[model samples]
Target: MNDEVAQQVVPRTRYHALFVVAILTGSFLLFLVQPMVARMALPRLGGAPAVWNSAMLVYQALLLGGYAYAHWLGRVPVRMQAGIHLAVLAVAAMWLPIGLTAMELPADAEPAFWVPWLFGASIGPLFFAISAQAPLLQRWYSVASGGRDPYALYAASNVGSFGGLIAYPLLVEPGLALRGQSLLWTIGYALVFLLVAGCATLLPRRVGGEPHVAHHSPAPGAGRVLHWVLLAFVPSGLMLATTTFLTTDIVAMPMLWVLPLGLYLLSFSFAFREGEALPAALTRIAPVLLLMFGSVLIAGDQQLAYVNALIGLLLLFLVAVALHSCMYRLRPAPDRLTGFYLAMSVGGALGGVFSGLIAPIVFDWTYEYPLLILAAGMLMPQAFLFDPIARLWRGSAQLLRIKTLAATLAIAVPLYLGLFNPGGLLGPMHEQVAFVGIAAIGLFSVGRRIPYLVALAGGLFLFGGYRAIETSLSGDRTRSYFGVYTVTDMPRERRLAHGTTLHGIQLKGARSRLPTTYYVPGSGVGQAMLAAPQLYGPAARIGVVGLGTGTLACYARPGQHWRFYEIDPAMVDLSRDSGKFSFLRQCAPQAEIIVGDARLRLAQTLPASLDLLALDAFSSDAVPMHLMTTEAFTTYARVLAPDGLLLVHISNRFLALSPVVAAAAARGGWHAARLVYTPSAPEKRDEAAISDWIALSRDPATLARLTGGQWQPLTPQRSFTPWTDDYASVVPVMRALNPSLADD
Candidate 1:
C-alpha cells in the first residue's frame, strides 16, 4: 500500500505557487488589519498606552481560535477542508472594509474589558478567517502536492506578514488616510479569496470508490510538543515587552509598535528558510547581544530616546531570530504541521496575555521584561563562541573557578561605585571603564549557563536595573493601565514623573503652592491661568483633563468651581496624596475629581458648562490619538462655554501636533492660536521645561484677546485636513528630529 501511494504522489511543482500566493496574501491581510482597526478605534477609546496591548491580546486570541479550527479540519478530506475554509472567508467578508461598529463605552467601562470586546466584535470574524489560511493552506499544500516540504512556505508566509507590517507604517499609513487604507484592505481580501479558490482548484478531486488520502506522519511526543511551545513563547512575550518598554518608558509613537512586530515576523523568515546560516550565526551571539543591550538599557537614562530605540529594535530582532530558529529546528513533519502550528499559536497567545495583560496587574514594575530576557537566555540555542571558553566549560574544575569569579563579580555592585565613580580617583571616564570591565567579565562566561547568567545579572544590575530596584525599594512607583508613575523627593522639591516626562514638581513647603514643570507661571498653561480672572469672571468654572499631580489646580481662585477628569486612578491618588504633590491640596482641596477615560467621562458631564477646558493629559511624549480626534474636539466644544478657550498641550519630541490640534480646531469652525514657551535655561524658570499649548475657541474675539507676544496664529499647512474619528492619520504630523528638540 505504501509503495502504491508513493508511486502516485505528485511532485511539489504541481501546487507550490498557488499555495504560496494564497498563504502570503492571507498573512498580509491578517497583520495589516491590526494597526488599521486600532487606529480607527482610537477616538472611541482614548489612546491610553494599554489600548494597543489590549488589541494585541484580542488578535492573539482570535489567531489561536483560527489555528485550532484549522487543526481540527485536518481530519477531513483535502477538498472538503478547502471548500469549508472558502465558505468561512465568504461569510467573514460581510464585515468588509473592517471598520468598527458604532458602540459607545459608558463612562464607567473598564478598558481592559471594553477594548477586547470592541476589537473582537468589530474585526474578530474577518481576522480569524484570514489568520487560519497560513497553516490551513500549508496543510492543503502538503496533501495536494503528495507530501513535499510545505514548511519552507511558512517562511514565505512570514515574509509577507513582515512586508504588510512595514508597508502599513512607512508606505500605506503615510500616503492613505484610514478610509482609503480600509478600502485597499478590502480589495486585498477579495484578491486573497480568489487566490484561496485557485489553491482549491489544484487539490485532487475526490472520485467515487476511492478512499480519502490518509497521509499521517509519526506523531510527536508530549515532551517534544512542550518544547515547541516554550521556544515560541519566549520570543512572542519578549516582542510585547520590547514594544511596551519603548512606547511607555521611552517614546509612544504609533509606528514604533510595528518595528518590533515586523522584526519578530522577519525572524520566522530567517529561522524556517532551508539551509540558512545567517540565523545560526545570529543564534550563537544573540545572548551576548541581549546581555549588552539589556544591561545598557536598564542603566540607561531617557536622554537618548533615538539611540535607545535603535538599540531596543536591534535587540528584539536578534532575540526573535535566535529563538525562532529553535522552533524551526524542532518543527514536526508535514502531516503533523497543523498540530505544530496550533501549539505555536497557543504559546504566542499565552505570551501576549502574560506580558500585555497579566504583567500590569500582577507587578508594580515591568519585571516581565527581565524575566523574559532571562528565559530567552535559557531557551535559545547557545554555542561556544571561542574554543578557550568551550574548554573551560567542558572541564569541571575550570568551570567551577569561572562560576566563582562570576558570582563574586555579580555581587560587586558597590565596587563599580567605589572605584569607577566619576567623582572618585578614576575621573570622568571611570563609568566607561567600569562598564568595559563588566562587559569583559560577561564575555568570559559565553557558553556556560550559570556563569553567563551571573554575568548578565552583574551587568544588568550595574547598568539599568539599579534604578528600578531603587524605585521599588522607595515605594514611590505605581503601575496602572495608563503606565507607570514614580515620585521622587529632591532637596528643593518633590517631583512626580509619568515615565520619562515630569508630571509635576512641587517646591518644598514654602513654594508648594506654586505650579512647576509645564505649569510654571511663564509657560502656556501658566499664561492661560494668569489671564483666567481677566478673561472669565471670578465665578468661572474650570475643567482640566489629565490631572498630573494636580499642578494646574493651583490656578484656582475663590468661588471658582473646578473639576478634573483623570483616566488613571493611580494618578488621582498620587496627586491628592499631599505627601507627594500638594498642588491640589494647597490650592483646590474641594475640586471634583472624576476617574475614568477622560473623553468618556467628559461626555457624561453637562454640556457647555465650563468657562475653560484644559486638555493636558499626556502619557509622557504620547498625545492620546483618541483625544485629538475630531469627535473628541466636538465633545470639548460642547462642554466648553461659547467663549471658553480649549487649551491643548502639544509639546512633544516626535510629533508636531500643533498642526493636528490646529487642523481639528479649523474643522470645528473655531479660531486657534499657539503659545510656544521656552524657559531659556533650567535655572531661570525653576525647572520648567519648554511647552507649546494651542488655544481654540468658537469666538474670534476670545482667541484674538489671547494672541500677542508669546501667542501667535497657529499656521496650519494648506494641504492638512483635520482628523475625524472615522479618519485620522499621525504620519504627517511626525516632526523632523532637530538638535534642540532631540530629547523632548
Candidate 2:
C-alpha cells in the first residue's frame, strides 16, 4: 500500500516539475524580449525615458490580450487547447530573432502614438503567444496532476520574469550586440516550444476531461472579479511611477530601470507561494511603511537621494507584495484560474495606461506617484501589530467612532501646523515634529482602515505634495512626452530645470546677456563658441542641438549664422517667447529655431552646412543614447565642414561619458580633447557650474585650436566599445568618475 502511494506521488511530482519548467521558460522569454525590443527601437524612436513607458504599455496591452485568449480557450477541451497553443507558438516563431520592422517614423510623428505602434508591429505576435503560457500551463498542470492546486506555479513564473529582467542589463546587454541578443532569445524560444510540448504530453488522455477540482467550486461573481482587478491595479501603477521617480528625481544609474520592475515581479513570487508567513508579515507591516516612506518620498531630499530611492523601492515592493497577496487570498479554486489571471491582466493594463499614458499628460509633476501610494494604502491588507489595538477597534461601534475621531484629531494637529504654521509655533523642528505625530497616529490607525487611509492622505499632503500643487497652480511647471520642466524666478536670476537637473539659469540686469551654468565663457563649449569666428572666419554657421534657455546663443557674433534645434516646443516657448529667459531674445533674436529631434533634422540638412555643431541634447539628466551613437556622429560629420568642431556636453552627475566619446572619436578618425571646467569661487557665485565637454574634429588643427589651454587628451577605455546604432549600453561608462559635475 505504501509503495502504491509512492508510485502515484512520483509521477505527479514529475508532471509538476515539467509544467513549472515550461512556464518558467516562457515567462523568462516574455520579459527578456521587452527590454531587448525596446533597446532595438532606441535609435529609430529617440531615447526619451517616456519611450520605455510606451513600450511597457504595449507589452501590458498584449499581456491582457494573451490572458483573455487563455480564458476564452477554456471552453475547448484540454487537448484542443494544447494543440491550438502549440500551433500559435509555431506561428509566432516566424517572427523569431525579433527586431523592429522596416517601418520608418514620420518626420512629424507623435511619440505617444508612434512608439506603441512601432513596438507592437515589431514583437506583438511573439509576445502575445508566450504571454498566455503561464495561465494555460497552470491549467494543464492541474488536470495532469489529478486536481492538485496549481496557483503555486505562478511563483515560478514570476521568478523567471525577475531573472530575465535582471539578466538583460547585467549579462546580455554588456556581452552581446542587438543581433546576438535576438539570436539568444530565439534559441530560448525554441527551448520553450520543446518544454511546452513535453508538458502537453502529460495532459489527460480524455479529450473533454475537466479537472476534478472544477466540480467542487462554483464560478466567481462579477464583484469578485472586480475585487481581483482592484487588488492588482495599485501595485502595477505604483511600479511604473516608482521607476519614473527613481530615474528622474534620484540618481540616474545605468541599471536603475530594472530595479522597480524586478522587485514588482519578485513580489508575485512572495505573494503566491504556498508559504504564508512572509506574505502575511509583509502585509501586516505594509501600512506603516506606506505612511512613513510615502511621506518622505514626496518630500524630495536630494541630499539623501540614493537612500530615498532605496526607501521608495522598498515601499513599492511591500505594497506590491501585500496587494498581490490579497489577490492570492481571494483566488478562486483551480477551475477559475485563467479567468482570475485575465482579470489581473486587465487591472495591470489599466494601471499601466493610467500611470504610463495618462498621468504624464494630466499632471504637471509626478502626481501619480503620490496618488498611487494613496491607492496602495487603501488596497493593501491591514492588521494590528498588537492584540490590544485590535481589541480597542473591535470593542463597540460608539467606541470605534470615538477612537477614529481621536486618531483624526491627532493627525490633524501636525498636518495643520506643517501646512500653515510651520516653524511658527513648533519652532525649527516643526516639520520633524509633524512627521512624528502623523507617523504615530498612522501606526495606531492600522487595522482600522478608514483612519489609516486618512493618515496616509495627510502624510502625502504634508510632505512636498502641497509644494507640487503650488507649482502646478502657478503654471510654472510644464509636462511633455519627454519629461517635466519647472521654471523658477530667484532674487537675481531665473532658472530652468528639467526634472531635478538644472538646465540653465539667467541672471537679471547687466549679466543677462552673459552665459551662465554650463555655457559660461570658461567652459569647453564656451571656449569652442568663443573661437568659432577664428576657426571658420566671421560668417561661421553654428548649430546647437539643445536650446536650453538659448544660453549658447550669447556667443553668436553679428555675422554668425546661428540655428537652434530643440525637440520640445514648450521649451522653445519658455526660452524664446515666454519672456522668462532673455538669452535668446537679447542675444540671438534672429537665430532660427527648428522644432524637432536634432538627429532627424540634422540628417535632412545639406552636407557641410555648419562650421560648428554643438551636441547638448538631454532628456532630464540622461543623454539620449541615440545622439551618442556612432551613426549619429556620422550624421554630425556629414553636416559639418571638414574642420568643423563637434562640441559634446559630457557633463553628467552619474555617468563618466568621456570614454564613450573617445571611443567614437577613435572609430571616426577624429582628434578629441576633453575639458574639465571648474569655475572660480566668484564664478560659482554667479551661477557658473562645473562642466565637462569633449571637442572633436576630423582636422587636428581645429581641435588643437579649441583645446589650447585647459583641455587634456581623451582617456579612452580600451575595453569600452563605441556605442553604435546596432548596440549600446551604459554599463561601461557608469563609473561615476565625476559625481560633482552639474547637469548641463
Candidate 3:
C-alpha cells in the first residue's frame, strides 16, 4: 500500500510540473506578441497612440472570451475536454507562421477603429486558444492530481506574462525584425501545443476517481460566484487605469507603460504561489499607503513627474496585493477555478470600459484614474486594528450599529472647511490643510462606513479636484489627440506649460510668418522663414503641419502660398476662430488649412510644390508617432522641390527626437542637422521660450542656406541610433537629454 501511494504521487507531481511549464510558456507567448506585432505595424499604420489603445481593447476583449470558454468547458468529461482543446489547438494553428495579413491600411481611413479590427481578426483565434490554457489546464491539473492545491500555478502563469513583456522591449524587439519576431512566436506556439499534448496524456481518466466519468460541477450558490468576479475585476481594471495615468505625459515615455502592467501581473504570482503566506503584515498597511501616497501623488504642483509615477505604481501594486490576497483567502476549491477566472474576466472588461471608453467621454481630463484609486481604497480590505474605533465598537454588541457619528461630524467640519472650502481661515496654507484632512479622514474611517467616504472625499480633493479647479478657472488648457496642452498666463506675459515640446506665443495678437517664444525673431525657424523670399521667392510654397495658434502664420508674405495639415478640429478652431490669438487671420488669411491626419493630407497634395515643410506640431505630450518615420519623411521629400527645406520641431520634454529625425533623414538620403534653440535671458519677452528645432534636406544648398549665418553648423551626433519601423529604442535617446531645461 505504501509503494502504491508513492508511485501515484510521483506521476501526479511530474504532471503538475508539466502543467506549470505549459501555462507559463503559453502566457509568455501571449504577451510577447502584443508589442512585437504593434511595433511591426508602426510604419504601416502611422504610430498614432490611439492605435495602441485600440489594440489593447482588442486584447482585453479576447482575454475575456478565452476565460468564458474555459468556464464553459468545465461541464464536459475529462477525456472530452482534453480532446476538444487539442482539436481547438490544431485548428488555431492554421494561422501559423503568423503575421499580419496583406490587407493594407486604407489611405484615408482612421487608425483608431481599423487597427484593432484588422489585428484582432488576424491573431484573435490563435491568442484565444493560448489564453484559455491558464484556467482550463489548471483545473485539469487539479483533477488529475486528485484534489491537490494546484493554484500556485497561477503565479507561475503571471511570471511568464512579466517575462514576455520585459523580454519583448529588452530582448525580442531589439534582437529581431518583425518577420523574425513573427516566426519566433510561431515556433513558441508550436512548442506550447506539443507541451500541452504531453500534459493532456496525464489528465485523469475520471472526474474524481471514477474512470470515464464526467467533470464535477461547482458548489451551489450565486454569492460564491460573485466573490470570484469582484476579486478578478478590481485588479484587472486598476492595472489598465494605472497605465493610462502614468504613461500620458504625466510620466510619459514609451516603455514606462510596461512598468505598471508588469508589476500588476507579478502581484498575481506573489498572491497565488504555493506555500506563500500572501503576507498579513504587508496587506495590513496597504490601505494606509494607498491613501497617503494616492492623495499627494495626484495633487501636488511639483514637477516630480518621474517620482510621482513611481509612487503611483507602488501604491497600485500594494493595494492590488492586498485585494488579491483577500481574494486568495476566499478562493473557491479547485473544481471552481474556471468559474472564478471567468468572473475575473468580466471585471477586467468593465475596467477597460471605465478607463478606455467611458472616462475619455465623461471627464474633461483623466479623472477616471483618481476615481479608480478611491474605488480601490474603498473596496480593498482595511485592517481591524487600523480601524480602532470600529474594533472597539465591535467588541460591544450595543455599539455595533451606533458608534461615534457625533465625533466624526465634529472632526470632519474642521477638515472640510480647511481643505475643500476655498478661502477658509486656513486659506493661505493649502498643503497644511490637505495634510490635516488626510490624517483626520484616516483616523475617522476607523469604525464606520462614514470614515471610508471621508477618506475618499479627502483623497479626491487633495489629489485631483483642487488642481483641476485651478486649471479650469485659469482658462489655460488645450486638448489635442496627442495630449493636453496648457499655456498658463503668467506674470510678465511668460506662460508656463506642462505638456508638449514647444509653445508658440504671439503678442496676444501678431502676424507675418515672424516668430515668437521658441521661434524668436532671432531663432533658426524665424531666420529660415524670413529668408523664404530670397530662398524660394515670394510665391514660396510653404507647409506647416501643427497649427498652434497659427503662430507661424505670422511669418507668411503676400502672395505666398501656405498650407496647414491639422488633425484635431478643436485645435484648428482654437487657433483660427478663438480671439485668444490672431496670428493666422492677420498674416495668412488666404492660406489653406486641411483637416485630417497630417500624413494622409500630405499624401493628397501636389508633389514637388513645397519650398519649406515645417513639421512643427509639438502642441502636447504625444509625439504623433506617424509624423517622424522614414516613410513619413519620404512622403515629405516627395512633396518638396529638390532643394526645399524640411524644418522639424524636434523639441520634446520626454523624448530626444533628433535621432528619429536623423534616422528618417538618413533613410530618405537627406542631410539633416539640428539647431538647439536656447533663448538668451535678454531675448525672453513675456513669452514661453526654450525650443529645439532640427532642419533636414536632400540638397546641400538648402541645408547650407537654412544654416547660413543664422545658426552654427550642427555636427550630427554619431551616438544617435536610427529609429526603424520594426525596432525603435528610446532609452538611449531620453538619457542624453535633460528634463529641467523647459521654460516652466
Q: lDDT per model, in order? A: 0.79, 0.85, 0.72
Q: Per-residue CA lDDT of candidate 1, range 621-731, in tens?
A: 766777888889999999998999888998876777776787787778888888888876644455677788888889999878767887888766677777776666667
Most lDDT-accurate candidate: 2
Output the lDDT of residue 641, model 3.
Answer: 96
Q: Which lDDT tens digits does candidate 2 get at residues 1-744?
A: 133323333277679788888999899998899888888887777665467777877898899899999988887778778899999999988887799999977876776799889988889999999999999999888877766789999999999999899888878988899999999999999999999899888876662234332344688899999989988888989998898788766666656768998999999999999989999988888888888889888887889988999999999999999999999999998878998999999888888888788988898898899999988888887888788877777867888899888888788888998777743887776777788888888898898888898888888888888888999999998887666789998888888877776778998998889898888899999888999889999999999998888899999899999999988887898888887778889989999999877887888899999999999986556768889988999999999999999999887766777878888988888889888889887666548888888999999988887787788888567877899987888776665533432232
Candidate achieving higher TM-score, 1 or 2 = 2
> What TM-score would you give candidate 1 relative to the actual structure?
0.92
Q: What's the ranking of the predictions by TM-score, best on top?
A: 2, 1, 3
Worst 10 residues of 2 by lDDT: 1-10
Question: Which ten-residue region of model 1 has the weakest summed lDDT?
Answer: 206-215
Which candidate leads the pack in TM-score?
2
Which model, 1 or 3, shows the larger TM-score? Answer: 1
Candidate 2 residue-pair clash tally: 0
